[model samples]
Target: MKILVVDDEPLARERLARMVERLDGHELVAQAANAEAALQLIEERDPDVVLLDIRMPGTDGLVAAEQIAERPNPPAVIFCTAFDEHALDAFGTSAVGYLLKPVKTEQLTQVLDKARRTNKLQRAELTDSAPAAGNGQRTYLSAKTHRGVDLIPIDNIRCLIADQKYVTVYHTEGEHLLDETLKDLEQEFAQQLVRIHRNALVAIAHIQGLERNAMGQCRVRLEGIDTAPVVSRRHTQSIRSLIQQL
Candidate 1:
């Protein structure tokens, strides 16, 4: 069976690649470090099996698998994540196989065989985290950092900017790579945040100004943040009206 291994950790990705090559009858077609690259390679290579990692810096593995499940004749997905606590989240996406890292070589072989026999994949809604925490208010967000998971207060957030396969949450403390989608954040923070661009959402209280450039294109200047978030033409009038209240 052809295989595609996706993991953000360089060592982890290389280890899987080496093992998959040694396994009988299976070929390691491609290796990707993030969800965005994985999706691109999956389309370009069309491997029969995708060995995915659940947690990553940008888009995360489950989100990528959910997208793979959308493609016609999508490849079989086998999650290889360190977070055993996310077992339920993995299966929630209709995955036929799941493995906790560090994955054993013999175990991988077994799952690949199962992939060959697995003919259908069921689809389900994939969510990055629980809808709410702390009395159902979702007052904080859990983000993974190099050291560990950091809990960021919702009130501290200034804006969210979409970058490649991930959306970065910009807050008072610092910036973070959020696993949540831009649309999801907009909906989740609807009362406090508003869309500034298709790729960005800014906090209403943090909104500084909506100014037009020499080109007549509107740009949103955020409070205490040097970078300006471009306001889309489609949302220009709406942002202008909101600026009046500010």
Candidate 2:
């Protein structure tokens, strides 16, 4: 995979560059000291992934990531920061990897491998269907799992259930926990998903049927999953209308 290293500190950039050289099947395409130069290089080089730093002279990495995401087929971003406090904010920008300063060779390799896999999957999806136009909404959700960062495709998600602070994403493969709030997810995927209850949002395309249980409580049946999420009375009529349309 082609790579770009972006950092304000010369020593830091050199360290990461050396690491990239040592890794097989990867090439260092360019280096930039700030977000401005990085963006320019991104257009010119079109690297597969970027190793970005948070603090810079101007246009911090976080903001730069948001801008990169707006571009069509943007390269994956892997943040290399010295602080852990920005971890949450980093993932919000659709970053696939987050590593602390003085990054280890093993960790960098792992993250890069994950990024390569994600890119391959995304390319396959594009070939299968017309790519969705960029609208600042994420096409995939990143989750930190035991293996590493898992990129869950938004279209494959069956539903999102909020228990408290974390939302559980039920997808085509299985379920995964996310740190995002349900409200934020609803806003982000409003067109593709619909709210069935206060704590749940089901994918609009996956809704198979709506039925009432023995006690007359409404529940929604979704394709590919046996567990039917309950439908609130307020949303029952809307769900019925949707079912009729289907």
Candidate 3:
């Protein structure tokens, strides 16, 4: 597989290059110091996979991934970082995998294989699933939660709370912390999910209204639900604006 190495540090790029060379069917085609360079190489080389760093000088890896993904043919991204807490949530991006710093050779091989398989699956799905081009809103998601992998429908989600690295997926019956991030799923499902806070995304259809208790802290009420989800005071205006739109 053709690969692109992206990292701000020279030593880190060298380490990844060596690892790719060690793999049987892998070759490093390009290397970049920042997101801009990475984007340029991706447009020119069209690599099969990108070994991307989460943190960079100009643009963070997550934001870079979003930009690349908007292109006509985007490469599969495998985020390399020191943080493991975000591994679960990043799965929403359909990334081949997330590798922590000082990545082991064995782990690299496993993730590479996984990436290859996932890339094939994504291509197949794109061809098989007919596009709804200008019709109704789309639903369904492939998420990794504590209960393992979940093929959750958007309608089933009552609310979503963005934790440090993962988003908590709440349903009518229960709630689960998904290994997926808010940015990964929020934009696509904007009509279905409403941004109550910078870190919190809730199902718009399920929201009943906004509430204020004796404590003066604003709370969000959901239809057919008793418990009220707290909406931070800072996000009060944002919530009200969204409610008016609804």
Please give the CA lDDT of all the candidate structures.
Answer: 0.78, 0.83, 0.74
- Cα lDDT tens digits, model 1, 98-154, are 888999988887777766654232211112332254555576665644322345678
- What TM-score against the true fold does each predicted structure earn? 0.49, 0.62, 0.53
In terms of lDDT, which candidate is stronger, 2 or 3?
A: 2
Give the TM-score comparing model 2 with the true structure, all chains together.
0.62
- As for model 3, its CA RMSD to the true structure in angstroms is 10.8
Prediction 1 global C-alpha lDDT: 0.78
lDDT of model number 2: 0.83
Clashes by residue pair, model 2: none
For candidate 2, lDDT tens digit of each residue in 1-246?
A: 999999999999999999999999999999999999999999999998989999888899998887776666778788999978877777555577789889999999989988888875433232332234377566777676644357688888988888978899998889999978999889878999999999999999999998889999999888887768889989889989988987
Pull out the clashing pairs in model 1.
none
Per-residue CA lDDT of model 3 for 123-150, tens digit only, reads 2222333123255444545554332134
Find the number of clashing residue pairs for candidate 2. Answer: 0
**Residue 8 local lDDT, model 1:** 94
Residue 21: error of model 2 in Å?
1.0
Report the C-alpha displacement of residue 205, candidate 3, in angstroms: 33
